[model samples]
Target: MKLNRRTVLSGLAAGSAVLAAPMVMAQGAPRVVVVGGGAGGATAARYIAKDSGGAVNVTLIEPTRQYYTCFFSNLYLGGVRDMDGLGHGYGTLAADYGINVVHDWAVGVDRDAKTVALASGATVPYDRLILSPGIDFKDGAVPGWDVSAQSAMPHAYKGGSQTELLKAQILAMPEGGRFAMVAPPNPYRCPPGPYERVSMVAHTLKEINPTAKILIVDPKANFSKQALFEEGWQKHYGGMIERIGPDFGGENVSVNPSEMTLDIDGVVEQVDVCNVIPAQKAGEIAHAAGITEGDWAPVNAADMSSKMDEAIHVLGDAAAQGDMPKSGFSANSQAKVCANAVLGALTDSRVFPAKFSNTCWSLIAPEDGVKVGASYEATEEKIASTGGFISETGEDEATRAQTYQESVGWYAAITSDMFG
Candidate 1:
C-alpha cells in the first residue's frame, strides 16, 4: 500500500463505522483537538482535515508560531544548512486545510470532560484528542544539570533557539578547546541524534579549529549506526573524536555548567563546551492526561489510540509504540494510520490495514550519509518489523555521496508533507 496521506484519505465515505463508538451521532461535526504541531500532530491534523473535506472540525494546539524540525537541525550546526531553512509556519495549514491552528501551550487534558485546558485559560472540547507533544527530559537525569543550566551546557535537543545557542557556543570555542556531549540512554528521541551531532560538531571544528577534541559520554554500550559513524569519524575526523561507553563509567556522569566541567565517574574534566542530551520522557501534557505509563504513552498499534482511553491518541516520540524508532519519519508514518482509522470512525470511511515505514538518515561528514530503515505491519501484539536495510560499513565515496543526496531529497519531501 502507498500509505500516503492522499491515498489513506481516498477511502470512500460510504462504509459502516469501524469502531464500536463512531461518534457520528454527535450533535454536529465530530471535533478533533490535536496537541503539538510537529510531525505526528501536524500530519494527523492535516490528513484528517484535508481528507474529511470539512466534514470534521479540527483544531491544532501548539505553543510555537514557527515549528523547527529536529530531524535536520544537526546540519545547521555543521553549517551545511541555515537556521532560516529549518523554520516552518502554520499559515498554510490554516488557510489551505481549514484547520484551526491555535498558538498556545496545552497545559492539561481532562479525559472525563473530554476537554483540553490551554495556557490561555481557554478550554477546548473534543470527541477525539491526539497528543503528539514530543520528548522532555527526565528530572535529575543528569544530576547537576537542569533547564536552568541549559544556557550554559545547552541540550539543543529540541530545535530553534537551543540549537542556535549551541551552534554559537561551538563557534565561540577557543583554539584547541574541547567539546563534550552527554548522550542519552535507551528509548530516546532520534536514535542517532547525538552521534550525528558529534559528527557535525567535529566537521565544524575540523574546518576552523582542527586541534579541538570531541568527547562523548554515552550510557549505552552501542548506538544506532555505530559502525557507520565510527568508520566515518575515523576516515574524516581521525584521532579527533573519542567515546566512553558504560564500561568506562559513562553511565555514571554529572556536569557543572557554571564550572564548565564534566564529571565522569569520579574523575572531573574541564571542557570548553558541553552538549547534554539527558534521558527523556513524554511531554508533560501526556502525563496530565493520565495516559502515560512510566515515561511514555502506550498506544494501540492499529490506530495509535491511547491504551488508557480510546478517545485519545498519542504519537511520535511521546508514544510507546513497538518496533518503530522515535523519529520524524516514524511519526509521520503513524499519523497516516491514525488518520485513516479516525476518518473511518467519524465519517464512516473505509479504514485500511495499518502499515508503517521509517528511515533515519545521518550525515557523518560533508556529502557523506548513512541510513537505517524498516517496513512494519500491525500484528495483534504490536507493530512488528517485516524487513529492514542499513548502509554498508565500507561503501565507496560515490555511494555515500548518493546517500547524502537521497537524504537531502527526503528532508525536502518530508518537510513539504508536514507543513503543506
Candidate 2:
C-alpha cells in the first residue's frame, strides 16, 4: 500500500480506463434515421452506415419498396429507357450495408424527442434525422384538379407508376389528336422537366402519329433551357409542340378531367390527353415535422442542417438551399456532405468541406441530348455556384450524341451510388 512508482502507475491507468469507456460507447451507439429513400436520404443513410463501419445505426424510412428515378422517366416515356431500368429497391442498402430498411411512411416527426413516427405505429429514435421527402402538389391550386384527379390526368412528376400512367395515356391518343399540359409554376422539382416531357411525348408521337399536337400552358414566362428546348422542338418535332407562356394565358388555366377539357386564356378546348403539373410545396412530412417556414425547410447550406431543428437535416427538394436546383445529383451531393457532418458530430470523424454539383440532361430525340450543370461550394450564406457549363444550342449531332451517352452513364453511376 506504499506510494511507490509502480502503484502510482497502476492508479493512473485505472483512472484513464474509467474515463475512456463512456466515450467509446457513446461514439459507437449514435443512431441516424433517414425519412424518404430517394436520392438524398438513401445516399446519406448508405454513406453513414458504410463509412462508419457499423459504428452508427442507420435506418431508412420509405413508403415504397421500389423507387424510380424522376430524372430518366421521360426517356422511358419516349422509349429510350424501360420501366424496369428505372426501378431500384432498398435490397442493396440492406444487404451490402447493415441499414434498417423500413418500408413504411414517415407519418410524423417529434423534433423534441428526435424520433420519427411511422405509419406502422412504431417510433424510431434518432440522434440525427435526415428528411428528403421531395415535393407534394399544392391542393386545388388549379381549379378542378387535386390528388383525386391525378389518375384521370397524371402529373408524371413523381416518376414510378405515374410515369407509366402518363405514357399509356399518350400512347392511346387518337391520330392527329391534341395533348395538353398544364406545366407547374417556378421552383418546382426539375425546372426543365415539363419541357423534357413534352419533347419525349413528341418523340413518341412522331413515330406513331406524326400529326399529333402537344400544347403546353406554362405559368412561367421562361423555363430551364428555354431557348434550347424551343429550338429542339422546332427542329425535331416541327409544328408539333406549342408552348403558351404567361402572355398567352398560361397563368389562368383550368382543367376538367372528366370532360377531358383544358381551359387556357379564357378559351376552352377538348384534348385527348391532359397532363397537369400543379404548383408544389415540400412533401407533407416536412409540414408534419414543423420544419418548413413556408413551402420549404430552411437549412444551413454548409451541412444541410435544419435551421428550425439542429438534430434534423433537410435535403433534396424539401430544402430551401439557394443556388442549387432540386435535382437528383444535387441531392446526392448534399447527402455526402451531410453524412460527413453527421458522422463527425456522432463519432468525431473527419468532416470535409461541402462541394456540390449537378448536371441535368434532357433527351430531345433518340441519341440527342442537352445538359446544364453547375459546381457549387458551401458559403456562409448559401451554397453558391462557382462554375458551370451547358451544351450549346447548335451543337453537332456527334456532340449531342455524346451528351446523351454521358447522361446514360450518369444514370447508371448515380443509381449504383444511391442503392448500392
Candidate 3:
C-alpha cells in the first residue's frame, strides 16, 4: 500500500479516535513519560499524545536528536541505501503529534516519586512511565572485547559510528582478505540481522574484492531463516560465505584485539576485519531502576505493566516476553498495546483485549529478500500466537520481487506509525 501524506494522516486520526473515545477526560488525563525515542518509545509517545487529544501530557526522553534504523543498515553497507534514507527526524513527533521530546539520557528512576531523573540533573515526574531503552551488551561475555577495542573490531549492532567503521574496514580490505563475524547468542535484537550483515557485506565484497570471504562464528547450532539464507548465499554469493556453528567449533569464545585474532574453540583465527555481536541485556537504566532481573525486565503480558511496579510499563527489547523476538517491528507492536492499556487504566474505561503483529525482513541480495512474521493475541498471563510463521520459502520470482517491494512499503508504514 502506498503511504502518502494523506494516508498517514488518516491512519493516525483513525487510530487516535478509536483509542481515545473510551478515555475522554477522566482524572485530568495522566502524565505519561516515555523513555527512549527509538522504534518502540517513539511509537508509544506519538500514539499516546494523539489519542489523549491534549488531555494527557506525553514526554519522550531520548538522547539523540535523530534515529538511524538498524533494520536497513545492511542496505547502507551494500551501497544500495544512504544515510539520509535511513536517518529519521523527530520534528513531527513534537509539532504534529503533540509530544514533548527531550534530548537527554535517563540516569535514574525514582519509582517512589514517579519521576525519571536525567543525567542533565532534571527530574521529570510522571503518572505513568513507559520504558523502551532497548538492549545493552554484556561486558566480559567475550573476553578482551570492550568499548575501546571496538575501534579495531566493531559491532555495528547499535548503528552510527560502528556502522561506518565496519563500512570503512570492508572498503579497505585487500582482495582475498577474510571478514569474520562473531554472531550473538539467541534472544538478542534482530535474529536475522547478522546474516543480513554478512549478505550485504558479501555483496560489496563481490564487487570490491571478488576473492574476499566471510566467516560467521556462531554459538548456536541454528538461526533465524537458516535454510533460506544458506540457499541465497550459495546461489548468488558463490560460496564466499561460510558459517561455523557450535558443532563445527564455530563458537566465538574470546577475542584478542592486540593480535587481531578471534579465539574459536581454542583455535586463533586471524582476519582482516571483525564484527562481534556480544550477548546483551536490558539497558542500564532499567537495571538501575530495579526493574530488571538478570538480563531482562519481567512484566505483565496483558498490559506490559512491570511486575514489580504497577505504574511503570516496559516494552521492546528491555522486557522479557516469551515467544516475541526482540525486533523493531515487535517493539512497535508492543508499544501500541501498552499505550491502549495505559489509557484504559487512567480513564477507568473498559480495556480492550490486545493483539500484536510483527514482520522481520532480511535481504540476501539486492533483489532477494526473505521474511518471517506472526500475529498474536494476549492471553490471561502471556501473549500467544494466533497464527504461525509465514515464510517466504518457495516464493516464485514474481512473488519474491513483490515481497521485496512490500518490505519497503512496510518500512514506510512503520516509520509513519512511529514518528509521522
Q: Write the per-residue lDDT of candidate 2 for residues 23-66, one digit (tens) a residue.
A: 23234578999999999999998888878877888889999999
Point to the candidate with the largest TM-score.
1
Candidate 1 C-alpha lDDT tens digits along 124-147: 999999999999999999999999
Instruction: Name the Cα RMSD for model 3.
Output: 5.5
Better of 2 and 3 by TM-score: 2
Q: What lDDT is obtained when candidate 1 is compared to the true structure?
A: 0.92
For all candidates in order, the CA lDDT equals 0.92, 0.89, 0.85
Model 1 TM: 0.94
Model 2 residue pairs with clashes: none
Count backbone overlaps in model 1: 0
As for candidate 3, its clashing pairs are none
Model 2: what TM-score?
0.93
